[model samples]
Target: MRTLAVTTMDPRHRVLCRIRIEGAEEAEKICLLMGSEVAPRRQFIAAGATELDEARIDI
Candidate 1:
């Protein structure tokens, strides 16, 4: 498993959320579980703590 970061643009919450994940697949899985609309690239950016709507695996 690789370490990944995820960022979210929650307009409803009016804030950006960040999280560290294990891998691309795992990130996607977690997004689905959370009902978050995220892209592979966004996961990577999020993991890197970069500003993005979505991303992929950083590791």
Candidate 2:
């Protein structure tokens, strides 16, 4: 029998380094790069704060 150690981290403190989407092989690289760019932004928006269309993104 083997035992594995597990660590849990709070989502609020999570460092979004990489994002991988299943079945999106070609898009994975693009997604990872985009995530890195987007994660550092201080949106000041909480979860469930706004609907999809209500969200504002500064381009």
Q: Please tell me which predicted candidate would have the highest lDDT against the true structure.
A: 1
Sliding window of 10 residues with minimal summed lDDT for model 1: 1-10
**lDDT by candidate, in order shown:** 0.51, 0.44
- Residues 1-59 of candidate 1: C-alpha lDDT, one tens digit per residue: 42233233444434444655546666565555454555755665567575543554343
Residue-wise lDDT of candidate 2 within 34-56, one digit each (tens)?
45566533342333346545445
lDDT of 2: 0.44
lDDT for residue 35 in candidate 1, whole number 0-100: 47
RMSD of 1: 13.7
